[model samples]
Target: MDIRLDDLTHPAIHALLEEHMAGMRALSPPECVFALDLDKLRHPSISFWSAWDGDTLTGCGALRELDAGHGEIKSMRTPNALRRRGAGKAILQHIIGVARARGYQRLSLETGAPAGFAAAHALYLGAGFVETGPFGDYQEDPFSRFYTLAL
Candidate 1:
């Protein structure tokens, strides 16, 4: 799979992001939903990436600079058609490498606590992320599970 920085304008990226947001909305309550939309993903602090296999969009993920020594992982998604493939893992490893290269000492992320999020939880855990309390501007929400990795 090819993973590269995305400007968030490609039609395939747009569609994948829409599907990701929709999936988040369906899985989490309105108040607990924190998935970023296209506009938010384009924020100056964030770097978005899309994973592709030839012409097909396989997955996407993003890294957001939280501070000089810290960063946040965001918008990780692999469409149903490509689920269980290595795309998500590849995107995640790419993000982690980018974070380390950027001089970030730590990397964090927030994901759902629901049973439906088990796969993601396992994925993060396997990627060296440890469960932790809320970080950054996040408050204590039972619906959310946070993870952090020391780079």
Candidate 2:
């Protein structure tokens, strides 16, 4: 798969993000949903990437610089058509690699706590993220689970 920074204007990226946001809404309430919309993802502090298998959009993920050495993972999503095919893994590994290269000392994320999010929680653990207190503007919330990794 080819992974590279993407412009949200790309139709496939928009469709993929819409699918992801819809899934989050169905699985969790708006307050608990950490998914970012196109405007948020386009922030200057965030670097977003899209994974493609030839011409097909496979998955996408982003890293947001919070400080000199702190970063956050945002909008990680692999389409249903690409689930179980290692697309999520590829996107995550790329994000981790990028974080390390950019001198980030840690990477953190927030995911839903609903049963429908169990697979995603497991995937993050498998990728070496560990549960932690909330970061950034986040607070202790039963609806969300936070994880962090030291780089």
Candidate 3:
């Protein structure tokens, strides 16, 4: 799979992001859904990436700058039809590598605490991210599970 920085303009990326947003909303309460829309992910502090296997868009993820030493993982999603194919892990590792290269001391992420997000939890934990308290603009939320990896 090829993973690289994406400009967030491709029709496939937009469709994938839209599907991600819909899935998040379906799995969590509206207030607990932190998935960013394309506009929000396009912020200057955020770097988005798309994972592809030749012509197929496998998945996508993003990293948002929280500060000079920290970065937040955002918008990690693989289509329902494509789960468990390693795209999730690949994109996550890619983000971690980029964060470390940027001199970040830590990489953090917020995901749902619900059972529907079990795969995500496994992926993060398998990649060495441990459960932690809220970071960045997040407050304590029962519906959210926070994880951080010390780089």
Candidate 4:
């Protein structure tokens, strides 16, 4: 799969993001769902990327600047039809590499804390992220699990 920075203008991206939002809402309560929409992902502080296998969109992820030395992982999703093809891990590794390239000291993320999110948890931990308390503006919540990797 080829992964590249996306401008979020493609029709496939819009559809994928919409699917991501719907999946998040289905897994977590509305109040606990924090997936960013297209407009939000377009913010200057966030860098979004999409993975494509030829003409097919497989997955996407983003890195958001929390500060000069810190970044947060956001919106990691693999379409239902294209999962287990290594796109998610590739996107995640790309984010981590970019964070290091930007001189970030840490990278963190928030994900759900249920069986449904086991794959995500495994992906993160397998990439060397350790469970931690909330970072950034997040708060302690039973529905959420936080992880951080010290660079």
lDDT string for model 1 (1-151, tens) is 8999999989999888889888888888888988899999999999999999999999999999999999999999999788999999999999999999999999999999988899999999999999999998998888899999998
TM-score of 1: 0.98
Name the candidate that leads on lDDT. Answer: 4
User: Which segments of model 3 are wrong by more than 4 Å?
Assistant: none
For residue 75, give model 1's deviation from the true position in Å.
0.2
Q: Score candidate 4 by lDDT.
A: 0.95
Native-to-model Cα distance after best TM-score fit, residue 46 in candidate 2, in Å: 0.4
Provide TM-scores for the models: 0.98, 0.96, 0.98, 0.98
By lDDT, is 1 or 4 better?
A: 4
Error of 2 at 15 (Å): 0.6
Residue lDDT tens for model 4, 14-88:
999999999888889999988899999999999999999999999999999999999999999999888899999
* Span of 10 residues, lowest total lDDT, candidate 4: 25-34
Residue 80's lDDT within candidate 2 is 83
* Model 1: residues with Cα > 4 Å off, grouped in runs: none
Model 1 C-alpha RMSD vs. true structure (Å) is 0.7
Q: Model 3 reaches what TM-score against the true structure?
A: 0.98
**How would you encode candidate 2's per-residue C-alpha lDDT over 36-150 as one tens digit per residue?**
9999999999999999999999999999999999999999999987788888889999999999999999999998988988878988999999999999999888889999989
How many pairs collide in each candidate, listed in order? Answer: 0, 0, 0, 0
Predictions in order: lDDT: 0.94, 0.92, 0.94, 0.95
Alpha carbon lDDT of residue 100, candidate 2?
98
Residue pairs in steric clash, candidate 3?
A: none
